[model samples]
Target chain A: MESGNLSAGEERFRKFSVYRIVEHLALIACFTVLAMTGLPQKFYSLGISQLIITSLGGIDSVRSIHHVAAAIFTVLALQHIITAFIGVVFLQWEPSMLIAVKDIHDALHNVKYCLGMAGRPAMSGRYNYKEKFVYWFILLGGVQMIATGFILWFPVIAANYLPGQFIPVSKVIHTNDAMLIFLLTAIWHIYDSIFNPEVFPLDKSIFTGMKKTTRT
Target chain B: METVINNKSGRMGVAAYIVCTALLVCFALPGQPSFAASEQGPRKVDKLFGAEGNADEDERNQCLKCHGEKGSIKKFPDGDFISTYVDPQAFTSSVHRSLRCTACHKEFSLQHHPERSFRNKLQYRIKESHVCRDCHKEGTIKSVAVHESLFRKERAGEAVVCTNCHSAHAVTPAVGGNASTGEEKYCLRCHSRETKMDFNDKECISLRVNIAELRNSPHKNMGCSDCHFGFSQENHPQRRFRYEREYRISSAEMCRKCHFDKYSKVSESIHYNMLSTGRLDAPTCIDCHGGHAVSSLGDNRALAVMKCRKCHGEVYDTYAKSVHGKALLNANNKDVPICIDCHSSHSIKNPSSSAFHDYIPEMCGKCHSNPTLMGKYGLSTDVVKTYLSDFHGMTLGLQRKEASKGYRPDPPMAVCTDCHGTHEIAGVLGADVQVLKDKLLKRCQKCHSNATSNFPDAWLSHYKPSLRVAPLVFIAEQFYKIIMPLMVVGLLFQVLLQIWRYLANR
Candidate 1:
C-alpha cells in the first residue's frame, strides 16, 4: 500500500491513504477469525481445540462463522485487486509493490551490512523487500485459500468442471498454506511492524498514514 | 467400557425399565432347586465347637461332631450321594440355627443313632419331608403362594421336599437379611436342579443353573435376589404369564439395578423402542447378557458380536467375514471393532437412520484420524481431511452449516459407509487398488447412475496423493510444501536483517 518514492516525504509525511488503512484492518479481522476457527478443525484432536469448537456452539457454527469471515475476506481481496487495477490503468499509477533487481541488490546489501560485510545498508524505494515479501505472500496465499475454500464450499459443482483430485488437493493446500500464512504473519510481519528495534512498539504508518522520515 | 455409559437415557427408557421390572415382580413364580452340594459350604468337621456363638450353636456343634466327620462326608444310598458332612458354620448361620437336631430328626436319640434307609434320594427326601408337617401344619403351608401348586403336586405324588428349595443345614434367613451371605445358596438349592417351570404349557423355562457357571459369572459376588429380586424361601408368589416373552422382558429388567448405565443405553436403543411398542421379538438385557451366568463383554469382545448373533445370525455371519470381524475373531485384535464397537451393546439405535448415516465418517474417523493409530496400520490419516474436502463430505458439511443458519440442503450425500459399506468395509490391508477402484465406481453409480468408469478416479480414496497415485494432486501439494517454507525463510531472513540494521544503527 506504500506507493510514494523513498525521497518523496518531508517530516512525518503521509504514506498510506485512509482506504488502504481500512483494507489492512479488515484483512487483519478476517485473518484473525479465520485462524481461530480453522486451526482447531485442523487440530481437531487437541482438547483446547475441542473446547473452542464446543464453546462456539459446535463445528457447524464454527464453520459458518469461518465462511462468513472468508466471504468478507474474499471480497476485500477482490477490492484490493480491482482498486490496484483501476489505479494503474485509469490513473496511471506506479506498481510500487512489484519486486525488482533493486530489491535483490538491496536484500543482499542489507544482509551483508547486518553481517558487517558492507559499509552501508541498502536504500529501499516505496516498499522495502520485507514489506513486498509480506504483501505478495499473503495476497497469493489468499488467492489459493479462496480457490480451495470455494471448491470445498461448492464441491459438487466443482466436480463438474474440476477433476476429483482437485478436491483433496485443495484441502491439502488450504490446510498447509494456512499454517504458512500464520507463521509468516506471526514471526516476520509482527517482527517488522512491532518487534523490530526501529519500530519497537509498532510501525503506525499503515494506520496513521504517515511516516517519520530519518534521512541520512 | 462400551456398554456402561451414564444413565442419561430419556424418561421413556426409565419407564420401560420400570414397567418391565414391575411385570417381573408380578410374574414371580418359584423355580425348582437341586441342593445336594450348594447349601453345604466347606465342612468344618473338627471345628464344630463355637462355644461363644448364638443360642443353638452348642447343640448343633455336638450334632455336627458326629455327622460332620471328614471321610464319611456323604450318605451313599444306592447311586445317590447326599452330603451328610454338615457344615457347623452353615448350621450356626441358618434361619433355624437355634433349633436342636432332634426338632427335625424326630424319633432319633443319643442312645439310638438309628440312621433310616430309603429306596432313593428323592424318596428319602420326601419321607424326611414329613417332619416339616410336624412343625408347619398343612393349612399354614397351603397358604404360601408356591404351596398352592406344590401341595397339589404332593397330593398327586409329585411334590419336592421342603429341603429341595431351602437346603437343610444352610437355610439363610428367608425374609429380609444380609445379601452378601449365602442368599444365592438359598435359590441355587433348588435352581441347581435340572427341572423346568412352565409359565404355560409351551413356555417351560429351565429352572436349572450350573452353580460353577453362576460362580464364574461377573455377578458372583451378587445374590440371586439381586436380580430375581423379592424371591426367597419367604414366599414363592404364584406367577402368571401368557408366554415366555413376559418372562424374558421382565428378566431383562434385572440389569438396570447394578448396570443402570448399560440399561439406560439399552432403553434408548432400537431394541427397547421395539419392545416398548409391543414388538416382543426385540432383544432386551437378558437376551444379550444372558440370565444368571451373565458375561463380561470387555474380556471377550467377540462374545459381544455373538450376543447379537442370537437374533442377527445372518448379519453376524456376514460381519464375521468382514475385515473388522475377521481381525477381531481370528487375531483377537482388541483394536478392531466387533458388533458393539459400532452398533453398541445396550443403546443401539437403527443404523439406517439419516442421523446415523451422516455420522459414518466421524465414527470411522475415531480410529482413521489418529495419526499414531493410522500409522500403526500404515494407513494415511489424511482420510478424514480428504473426505471432508471431497464433494460428499463437503455437501454434508454444508448441510450442517445450513442447518445452523436455520435451513438444510439435505441432499442425498454419501458418507464413509456410502462409498465403503458399513460392516462390510473393504479391507485396506493389502487390498488391490484396481479392485477398490472398481468397487468405488460401483458405489458411485448407486447415486450417480450416469457416472462412467473414470468417475472413481476423481475420488483420491483417502490417500494423500503421491507420485504413484494422483500425481497431479501430488505435484500441486509438493509445490506448496516447497513454496511455503521458502517464503517463510525469505520473510524471516528479511526480519533478521532489519533487526540487525536497527540495533547496529542504534
Candidate 2:
C-alpha cells in the first residue's frame, strides 16, 4: 500500500488491492439486479414488468430465481458475519471498529466542530459514526429481507404455523424491506463508497482490509 | 483453528451446493404426459351398392350378365352381344310390367344406353312416384270442384287428398268408405274439406302457432300435445277460442295448467303481485321458465345465476365466487336461495315493498339463521348474522322500511344479498380470502364515498338477539354457547387458583 499523510497539505493517497474492490462491486451488482427484477412485479404495470418476468421464464420462474439468489446472498451474508466475528475475536485487527460510547461523543464533537465550538477533529477510526450507522442498517435490512423472504418462499409451510393473515403481511414486509434495502444501498453505500470525496471513486476494504487514506 | 474452520466450511459448502443442484435438477424435469394414444386410420364404410374404384361398370355389367343369359350365345349383326330376361314371375309381381320393358328402358341395345343414363332414368321414376295428372284432367277438375263446393261452402267435412283417397297403381276404395279416425295416413288424408276440426279456426290457428313457436323457442323439449289435451280424431269436437283480451292473456296459463307444482309456488310469490294486479313490468313464468324451449332448471339450457346477475348487476358481480355461487354451480342445489327464493319468483312486486323490507332479515333468517338447515346443506348460517351486524346491514336497519321502499336510503346499506349473494347465499367461513377481501371493501364502499384501508371497521351486526337464526348467527350462537362459557370459566378458574394460593399464604 502507498503511504499517505495522517493530516496532509500533501496530495498523497493510499493504494488498495483489486480483489477488495471487486468483492464490494459484486455484492452491489447482485443486490441491485435482484431488486430491479423483484420490486416492479408488485408495484408497477404488468405490461413492461412481464419482460423481466419472462427473463426468468415466468412468474413462477422469477420467484424461483429470486429464492435461489436470496439463498446465495444469505450464505454470503453468513460468511461475512462469521468472517467479521473471526476477524474481531481472533485477529483483533481493528478493535476500534467496535461500537462504543465514543461514537456518541464523536457525533456530538463533530456537530460542535461544524458549529465552530470545537477546536479540532475527533480522532476518527476506520469506521466513523456514519459508516457504523450504515453498517448496522445493512445487517438489520439483510436479516429482515432473508426472514420475510423465507416466509414468502414457502407460504404453505409458513401458513401452517402462522395465521392466514401473515401471508399478505409477509408480502408487504418483504416488498417494503427490499425497497428500503435497495434505497439504503443506493443512497448510503454508493454515496460513501464511490461518491463521497473521502473515498472518491471506490472503497476496497471489503476484500483487502487495507486502509486507504485520501489526502485531506 | 483457521485451517480446521476452512476445511470444515469448504466441505459443507460443497455438500450444500450438490444438494441444491439436485433439487434444481428435480424442479427442472418436465411434466408427465397426460394423453392416451388414439387408434389410427380412417374408418371403412360397409354397405352394398357401394362404389369402389371403377366399380360402377362392374356392378352394372354383373347385373346385365345375369339378366341377359339368353343373349350370351348368339352375336348380333352389329357384333355386340344383346341380353334380355323374360321371367315368368315378372308380370304377376311388377306394378308396371303391363307395359313392355322397351318402353321404360328406351334405346334397348347390346351396349349401354345414351341420351339419359339408365340409373338416372330409374332414379327419376322413383322420385316422381307416378304421373296420374298426365291422364286424368276431367277427373282432377271434378275432384277440385267437389273440394271447392264442400270446403268453400262449409257444408262438407272430410279428410281426403288425391294421394290419400286414391292409389294410382290400384285405384281402389281407401277403407272403401268414410275414413276411420285413427288411420294415420299423410296430413292430406284428413286435412281436406271432408275433415271436421276439433277446434274453431282461430283456436286451431292459435294452438298451432303457439305449439310451432314453442317448438322453435328454448322450450323445444316439450311434446306438442303436452299442452293440448283430449286431442284425437274420434273425439274431435269444435270448441270456441279461449282469448282474454283484457289480460292480453299470457302463455303462462298453458304452462301452469300442467306444471302446477312450480307454477303455484311462483304464483304466490312476490313476483305475481306485480303482474296479476297490472304491474306489467314484472316477468312471469315464460320469462325465466322459457316459453318455447321450456326446460327443467337441471337442463344445460336453463337459466343460471349469471342470468339473474344481468338485472342485479352490482350484487351478482360481487358474488361471482361467493360460497353461494360455487354451491349453485357445483351442487346445483336449488334449496339454497336462488333469485326467486330471496326475491320471490311470482309475487316479486318490488324489492322495496315495505311489507317485505323488514322481512329480509327473517327471510334470510329462514335458511341462514337455521343451524340445522345450514348443516343439511353444509353451509354457514353466519352470513345473515354477520351481514345484519355488518356496516351495510346496520345502515339498512337504521333506514328501516324506508330503504326497502325507495332509493337506497344509505349509500352503502349492507343487505344480506350484497355480501353473501342474492341467488347464492354461501357464507364466508369457507370462502377464499380474495372474495372476502373484495366483499369487505365493496360492502363498505356502498355507503362510504371511497372506502380505503382506514375506513371505519367492517361493522358486522353479529350475534344480535333480535334476528332469527341465520346460519351465521347460529354459528355465533354456538360459539357463545361453547367458546364464551369456556373462556369465562377458564379465566374464573385461573383467578380462583390465584386467590386460593394467596389466601393460604396469608
Candidate 3:
C-alpha cells in the first residue's frame, strides 16, 4: 500500500499518502460547506437560495457556518503548502506540481496531439499539463479568496489599515473569485476527474491514495 | 203593430237618458253639494282657516287677546304647568310673524281647547316642537341613540326640548342669522354651567366648556354644528358612550369627516394603530389639539414636546438628559431638534420598519448636513457627505430607494442611529477620545464577532479619506478600484478566447 514501484508486472502505484488523502477529504468537506453557504448570499433573491438559507437556520447561522468552513479551508490550504515545502526542503523530493518551462512545452505538445498534428500524446511526469493548470489556478484563486474573505469577515479590523473603500472592493473580489472557482471546479475539474472517458466514474486515487496503472 | 210599439219604447228610452244627463250636470255644477260634502258636512274646519266672512288675522287676534298677557299659565290636573303667554313683540319680530298660531296648533279654538295630557312642561314642549317637522323637514332630525336612550331612562322633567335652546316666540331662521354666534350661545346655555350635568339619573358628566377659550380659538368662527353636524338642541347628547374611550373614538370619527385626508394618514400612524388595538391612552385630535380651545400649533416647540411627553415619559426623560435637550433648555436654542423633528408630527410609522429604519440616516442628514443650520453650532456639514460615500451609508441609501419601491431590503446596514443613540443622541465631539473609541468598539461588537479594540479604528467617524486620516485605506481603495475592472475584463477575455478555441478545434 505504501509502494510507488513501476516494475513491469506492477499493477498499482501509491499516488498519495494517507495524510494527504485525509487533507483532501477535509478540503472537499470545507469547500462544499463554504459554497453551499456563500453562493446563496450572492444570489440571495433566488427561491432556492432563500430555501437553502432557511434550511441552514437563517442568514446569521449560514454566515457563522460559512465562516467556520472558511477557517477550516484556510487551515487545510496552509497545511498543503507547508507539506509541499517540507517534502522539497528536508526530504529532498522534487515538487512535481510546480509549473516549469517543461510544463509549457508539454502543454503545447498536448494541444498538437489534440489537433491531430502529433501521432502520440506528450509524456508527463507525476502530474499532467491539464492537472498542473487546474492545480495552479486553484492555488492562486485560493490565495486571492483568502485575502478578500478575511478582509470581509473582519471589516472593522481591515478598515483600520485599509481604506473604507477596500471593504466594498474586497466584497467584489471575494464574490467574483468564488464564482470563478465554482465554475472551474464544476466544469474543468469535475470533467477531468469524473466525466472524462478515461476516468468514467471517478479518479479515486485522491480518496484511496492509490491508482492502478498499465505498462506502455 | 210591433214596429209602432218598438219606436215608442225607443223614444221613451232617449228621454230618460236626456233626463239622467241633465241631473248629472246639475250635480257637477260649482254651486252644487257633492256626496262627500253631504256626508261629513265640511269636516270641522282646521283652526288655521276661518269661516266665509272671517279673516285668519281676526281668529289669531282672538287667541292673542288671552295669550298676550304675561304670566298667563295653564295648570294641569297633574300639577305640571305650562306657560300659555305669547310675547307680542317677540312674535312680531320673529320670522314666523305672518303665520297664525293655529298654523302649528291646528286644534286651537275659543270653544274647545284640547286637554293637555303631558306629564311635564318639557314633555309638552317636546311634543309641541313636532310642528316644526312639517315645514323644517330637512331630513336632519333623526333621533340619535344617546338622546333616545336618555329619553327612555330619564324623568320627563329632566328631558331636553327644542324650546330650551330656541325660544318659541323669538324663533329665527337657522340659516340667515349669525349662525355661529347663535349656535355657540345655544350650546353655552347648558354647557357653560360650572356643575356636573345629570343624564338619565344614573350618570353625570361635566357640561362645562370654557366659553372664553373657545371664542379665542382658531375655530372661533366655526359653528358647533360644523363638527357636530347632526346634533340639535332636541337631539342633545347624540350618542351614549360606555366609556371615555368610546367617546374619543367617535369624536375622532367626527374629526375625520372634515380632515379626512389628514385623518386617513394619521390612521396609519403608530398612535392610531395603537388606539385601534385598544390602547386607550393613544393620542387623538383633541389630545394634542384642545377640543374647543384648539389654536395654532405654531413654533411652540416646548408645548409640542410636552404633549408627546404625556405618553412617552421615559423617552422624554432620556431626551431631556441628552445633549440636544440640554442645549434647548440651557440656551433656548431653536436649532436643536425635538421629538416631532425626527419622528414627525403625524403619519409616523413604526421605528423598526425597514422603511423608517432606512430613512433614519436621511433624517439625521436633514439638520446635520444643513450648512446654514449646523454652521451656527460649529458643526461640520460634511458628516452626511462623508457617510454617503462610506460602505454602510451607501448600502443604506440603496436599501432605502429599494424600500420606497416596496421591496424588503436585505438585512439592515449600519445607519446613523446604529452607532449614535436614537432619542438619547449625544455630542461625540466633546467626549473624551478614548471613551468614544471604547464606545464605538462596543457598538461594532454588536454585529461583528470577536471584535478587538483596534476594530473601531477602522471607522472614519463620518469623514472621507485624507492624507492625515486614512492614507493606507485610501491607497488600497484606489488600487482595487482600478484593479477590479481590469481583472474582470482579463478573466472574461480569457474565458471567451478559450471557448472560441474549443469551438474552432471542434
Top candidate when judged by DockQ against the true structure: 1
Whole-model lDDT values for every prediction = 0.71, 0.48, 0.68
Question: How far is A143's C-alpha from truth in model 2 (Å)?
Answer: 1.7
Which 10 consecutive residues of model 3 chain B have the lowest summed lDDT?
B21-30
Model 1, B133-174: lDDT tens per residue?
664455545655665677766787776677655556665433
Model 2, residue B431: what's the lDDT?
67
C-alpha RMSD for every candidate: 15.1, 33.8, 15.1
Report backbone clashes per prediction: 6, 40, 2
The DockQ for candidate 1, computed on C-alphas, is 0.20
iRMSD (1 decimal) for each model: 4.5, 23.8, 6.7
Ranking by TM-score: 1, 3, 2
| Tens digits of lDDT, candidate 3, B1-506 | 12422466643433332222111111111111111121111111221122332355676678888898778997766797887888665554443555667777867765667776877766678788767545433222223333344345435555445444445655543322222126565556446655353434356667578989888898889877788777643345545566665566667667787788879889889989998898887889888777887778677777778888887899999889888888876776778898888888888888888867878878998999999998888898998887776557654544444454465644577788889878788898788989998888788777775677766766778666666666655655566567656755654554444444455555
Encode model 3's per-residue lDDT on A64-128: one tens digit a residue. 89999999888888888887889999999878888888888987775676566776557777787
Clashing pairs in 3: A162-B473, A163-B473
Provide per-model DockQ scores.
0.20, 0.01, 0.12
Predicted complex 2: CAPRI docking category: incorrect
* TM-score: model 2 vs. ground truth: 0.37
lDDT of 3 at A201: 92
